[model samples]
Target chain A: MMSFSLIVGFFLLWEILCIALNVSDLILPRPSEIIVTLVTRFPVLWPHILQTLYSTLTGFVLGVIIGVSIGVLIGTSRVAYGVAYPLLVGFSSIPKVAVVPIFVLWFGSGTTPAILTAMVICVFPIVVNIATGLATTEPDLEDVLKTLGASKREILWNVGLPRTMPYFFASLKVAITLSFVGAVLSETVASNRGIGNVMMTASSNFQVSLVFAGLIVLALMGVALYAFFSFLESRVTGWATRGNDIAIT
Target chain B: MSMTSDISAPARPTAALQPATQPASRSNPVHPRPAIELQDASVVFGSGDKVVTALSPTTLRMARGDFLALVGPSGCGKSTILRLASNLIQPSSGIVLLGGREPAAKELRIGMAFQNPTMLPWLTIEKNVMLPLKIVEPFKRTFQQDKKGAYRDRVHALLAQVGLQDFAGHFPWQLSGGMLQRANLCRALIHDPDLLLLDEPFGALDQFTREELWQILQDLYLDRKPTVLLVTHDLREAGFLARRICVMSARPGRIISDKAVTMPQPRDIGVIYTPAFVEMTQGLRELIAQIRK
Candidate 1:
């Protein structure tokens, strides 16, 4: 599942080539040696992994709350939406990675800068999704409510917000994954700890095997976080699917 | 918007519009009424090149327990008239009154069935049917107190009447078009509105289902007798269900013919194949053709 055996197979092929060429172990340290190094260093790497996971999770949660709230506000009011939507679009188009140094300079390294970086890049999807869902409420249904003399507040609470949930949750899942990527990128530049810092140190010291392990952890973290959010998404949207009624005639 | 006029019936309460907007209220009919009235009202939407007159001014009165249908082609404004009567849009250049004098009463306990069925896709069928009562005050206040019993019983009863009893727990998508439309009908009528406006309620169903619903609708009308205004392009449906069908012309829609169907009560589907039924459908069809021209 980790694809380690495939790397082992490639190393075996490389080892055979090295033997034929009479290459030295010092020049191309045997794959077995790298494995020994990987095992020993993994213990050292554990704290770094924890640091990255903490920053990523915090960033994701903070970004999602702010994004979804703003999204709902923009989505509901036509006048506010018209005035502010273009600015949101412009902001979303900017490559957030380019602004990482600015955030680090302002927040001064560690989890704070990393979080600001992740949130900057990850909040747009929630806004766009919620706004679209709320904007397209069925006119017929609205008319029915109006004729019945329902207050605007009642219509919004009973209909508008309920209709927007599926889109909101979907964007949340995507945003969580993006937030993690943003955290890693931010850590690569400014963090003292975290997986990104270890990878940076390993590359500088030519510890390619340890660097490989760190990457594996990065991928695993992303997948695990994505899985976690997917489960949350399904649970949150269970009501939405049931409301759509796919069972009876 | 022009869309308003494009879909509503053009025949308005012209007689009322000609008189003062503050014209003396006509004496209430001696009979108890369903609570909807339009006095010489005309609705003109948009301006210049986009100008559309959905309904011409004409006095129209629908009493309680009356079952009426407006038969017209596309752009004839049948649905517009229903919207105006339901107070969805204000009538331009005329007065459209509801439930007599009280501004609050003027809103009328009105229900409407649209082609989309328009059920909130996220709510279950029972919840959708109970939707109107949740938001529309008096009912909203009453709904809070009767939380446990009122909605469930009423939703079940209405869906059962339309043969969706088992689907009370289902979502809108789980149901077929006919079933969804049936649910939508129940949703509109759930408030037990005194007046019901149906815009092509069965227009999207299969012929068999359409005919089947004719009886279901007839039964519903028989039971509740809400002052009903059905807007449709179907001549046979109008002939079968309505006590009176107002045939409307295209573009600037106006009532061209007011045909009364005196067919005996409880019009069973078998009566549809009768000679009298055939003649009536033909007559209505011809009236539409004349208007189309």
Candidate 2:
């Protein structure tokens, strides 16, 4: 309730500042104008919003699957970690925007390139988080399992996988937003659909209110997915983080 | 000293009478074998210039069902004995055997508990106790096929032994440290291993909690009778629980003394104040003090 009111107050202040400065619509549209554009352009904007959502969702899911697999593999084996970690770091360091052109050339300016870009951009964090989770198994706990004659595979399945869940869920919250950024970046550069493309077309035509409208829609989608994953994290991995609650109380 | 013995005199007569009937049980052809044997086994960590000897050709043996404690000052390589016995680390020299032979992969049957409870936080207490059954087999192979819920019953029974029957559905995080430690004990013993290894399993608990766990552990040991090897620095704890106490020297640790504890079974907390128990602790404490110097 408090956050909602604060956000409303901030937008009201922005509108007042715009009017007081006599800002032109071409330079900066009022929040009121953006809302009006959002409502009036809903029919035209809905398809673009749906397209971005579809591409981002597809890319995020694929990224999680591939990233978790690679993370587990690298986390469990020293040789694999040593061989793959540096390569992963170097690959992730390269700005994902730079790869948009290559993806567009290969996949030809559609949802495919957007999805591949999102997947590429979103996978690194999941892999890093899952790998860190697996790598940090308590040595005492490992000893307890080892003495029971558990094979490495058994330990990984029974203990390592469950241990990595909180980290995996945390990465989802971060990666979901990155997936949106990736999809939008690819769309603005090459795609003919999605909110990114709509924003690009609107800005070029000086429909600044529509551009702001697209950004609002993108942020709403990001927040919805972030809240969804946060809910899942609390429910599924509550035990891993319940210690913090005890400390706070 | 006579006054101390006078207080314990009544307990001894009954204890002496009870052992006479034990020979009949011993005469049975199913004689107990040595549970763990470390024959001149030495461990050295690292190699070349960085090499550090942890245990120096330590030879030790425990009769099946014996409760033995290893006590020494810090950095005395007491834990190396546990690591070697569990096959977690190979000894640099000599042989370490379990149940009269080199432990084969399938024959690896040992239960271990450590100072930290190490419970899987995601699992309920019942599930945590049942974890070993899913890994070590013959249970492992048939765990999925047990439609009768026999494994669940076994876990429940083990949890009941530790008085955690009511908390079986609770996750580890909800339980107190002492409760988690009890669950840790249940997890260790659920598979019915031939040997139980404890590395200061109650070290982290408070004095009162530690004493309470000592009784629980003693009851469980008496009930199951698995050969136990406990490594601890607490001499009083050693005297109270173990049938034999082995004192190790400083680094490159070797057994300096292995003394038999002749105190009878089902001993009480009151026994610690008895002159004989105090004498045993004093002797071991002196040995450790000398090694420290």
Candidate 3:
């Protein structure tokens, strides 16, 4: 439904601009011409889209796993939080997008650079969100466990992990979208193939609809990842869930 | 009830007598005797110019099924005593043998309910109560047997005892202070521990609710008869619930005075208005006052 609306919206704008000023085909291709190009170019673009999906998903999973572990570590331990938290905040503030070229230089073109870029870009929020969740554990629960002859493992497993889950799930959702963005950007700068590379090629050839198609694929991919995490949230939290409104953070 | 320590409990009196003196008798004719065998138990926080003795080298034996209350002023190490029992921190010197073992993970069948009644916000009241049974043993055997069925049955029974059978599905945040404290008792009792330690549990409750819980607790003790160490500032509660009230001094806390209050079973709230309850409350309050000085 969304893709149909987006297509219609793009066509209306494309047709209006093309007809009003009688614009040159090279400068702004007519909507019909763009559609024709999209059909003819689908076979070429499909593989690049797959490549980007692989890199983005790979990077996202890696980033979230590492981020959550670090977050839990820092959040639960005073020494770790003092050492790691400020550095994370500072590192997140730096323009991570600027490192796309550096990643390419180190890893050499194609998938590696794109995956590394996505992973780096995706980690900060997951760490911050998970850390906040772990730090915010109810003081009462901690005391109860301590007094009940519970070990550190028992407290972490029964109370700590379940308590911080909403945060972890929330951070994963954000990381999914950001990872795709990172993958596309890295593909644009360095990759031989990917949705980003396809979009760049489409724009150079004056295929506006094909560019829009690639953008549509990127949007759909992000949404699909979000939906996957949503399913996961329901599974993990069903035991202790209050209601349907599962606020991640 | 295996009598291991030979600390025999004086038999139930056929006719209630007016607070009989517990004849300084430590020796009881039983196999498994439980006496709080503390040789030189002490705790010193910091040192030198800032040296603080939270509890001095003192000795006292609280019998197995005794309702002992530690009453003192703020910062008087009343709470420190409860912590020492739970093995939250080891004493600087000496030991505390809970049923012949130094408070290991599973040796001492101990349960703690804090003042806040800190129920895990995530679990429902039923699930929270069932939690202790899942962790501690034999119940773990029951946990493995038809896990959900066993837990549900146990939870329901516990919730009923706390007058929270209808609210089993509710979260901790949804419950009021009175309900939470009731749930706290259910959680502590869920494991059926030999010892139940209370650290100013009702201190935060309003007077009415606190008194109501005291009555609820009196019945529980009469039924379960668990060895209870209750620390409280409210002399009325201490006087009403505890069989023996240990009045402690400020800082370097020690059992300065141990007074006994013998009241009948299932104590009614009407008893609080009676002259006997008032007199005992006043007497304990004076003892605390003298220690505070």
Candidate 4:
């Protein structure tokens, strides 16, 4: 309740400042004007929001699947970790925005480039987090399982995977935000549909309030997706964070 | 590393003379096989210039259903002995046999509990205790198909034995350290293993909790007489629990002494204060002191 009021307070202060200055709407729109644009331009904004959402979600899901698989492969074997880690680090270091042009050249301006960008951008963190989680299984715990004649596969399935849950979920929260960033960056560069394109078109047309509205919708979607994953993290891997008790019941 | 006394070479003559007095039942005609045996087994970690001999060639044997404790200073490779018996690590030299056969060839079931209490945090106490059943075979083959709740009933009964029945639904992190250790014990024993290996299983607990767990371990051992090998530094704990205690020398570790405790079974915690128990522990303490020096 306190946080919600503080956010509202900040917006109100901004609105008051905008009105008192009698700022040009083109230069900086009031919060009320942005809200009005959001309400009135809902139909115009809806399709772009959906396009961005579709690209982000599809890319995010695919990224996670491939990331987890590769992470496990590297995590389970020292040889694989040695072989792949440097390569992954190098790949992740290349600014993903630089790849957007290459993606645009290949797929042209549509959802494909945005999605491919999101997948390429978002996969690194998931892979690193999951691999670290698996690699860090306590030696004593491994000894305990090994003494029972548990095969490596069994140990991986029973202990390694469960131990990786907290890391995997943590990466999901990070990856979701990155996915949005990737989608938006690609859309701005080469795509014709998503909120990024909408914002770009609106700014060019001098519809500053509508551009702000596009940003607000994107922020709202990011927050909602982040919150959903956070909820899922607490639910599915609660044991990992059990003693922390930072989350409200 | 500084070289310690070659304890095994010096102690061999004494060890050979002593085994004759290790009770007739151990050599009884009907049951000739020792539960676990390490014959001249040595473990050397790494190779070339970095090579470190963890356990010197050591031979030891435990009779079926015997409770033996290996007590030594830290890094004396007492744990290596347990690991060798469990086949978790292969001996660099010589043979380690369980039930008079190579460990790999034998259908040996081993239950092990460690100092950390190593309960999987994700699993509820009940599920954690039931873990061995889901892994070790014959049980693994039928655990899911036994839809009659037999496995669950067994888990509940085991939890009840450890005074953790109420916490069966609780996650490991929700439980206190002592409670988690008790759950660890239940998990180790759940499969009804032929041999039980404990590596400082109660070393982490406070004095009161450790003593309480000693009683729990004693009762469990009495109820189901499984051959037990416990590795610990606590002489009093060794005196109170094991029928036989093997004291090892410092690293490049080898058994220096294997003394039998004649204090009798179902011995109470009060036994630690008795003259005989004190003598036993005192003997071990002096031996360790000499080795450390």
Best of the candidates, TM-score? 4
After superposing candidate 1, which stretches have Cα over 4 Å from the reference? A1-39, A238-249, B1-34, B101-106, B142-148
lDDT of 3 at B121: 78
lDDT of 1 by residue, A1-249 (tens): 346688678879876887788766545655565667767887898898888888888888888888878887888899979987999999888887888889878878888988887887788998898889889877776776887777788777777777778887788778888888888888888888888988898888887767767777887788888778777767666766555445321
Which candidate, 1 or 3, would have the higher lDDT against the true structure? 3
Candidate 4 clashing pairs, residues 3+ apart or interchain = none
> Which tens-of-lDDT digit does each residue in A11-84 have in candidate 3?
79878988999997766667676667667787987898789989999998899888988888998898999999
Q: Which candidate leads in lDDT? A: 4
- Candidate 3, TM-score of its B chain: 0.87
In order, what DockQ does each candidate have?
0.57, 0.77, 0.44, 0.70
Ranking by TM-score: 4, 2, 3, 1
- Higher-DockQ candidate of 2 and 3: 2
Global local distance difference test of model 2: 0.85
| lDDT values for all models | 0.76, 0.85, 0.78, 0.87
Alpha carbon lDDT at A81, candidate 2: 100
**Ordering by lDDT:** 4, 2, 3, 1
**Best by the DockQ measure:** 2
* Model 3 TM-score on chain A: 0.84
- Candidate 4's clash total is 0
Model 3 agreement with the true structure over B1-293: per-residue lDDT tens digits: 11122223233332221432443225444515453455578988888899788998767666777788888888888888888887777889988777667777456677888888878877888888888876777676667674578678877886777678899988887889999999999888888888899989898999878877887787778888788989898887876687777788877788777666677555555555566677777776777787667
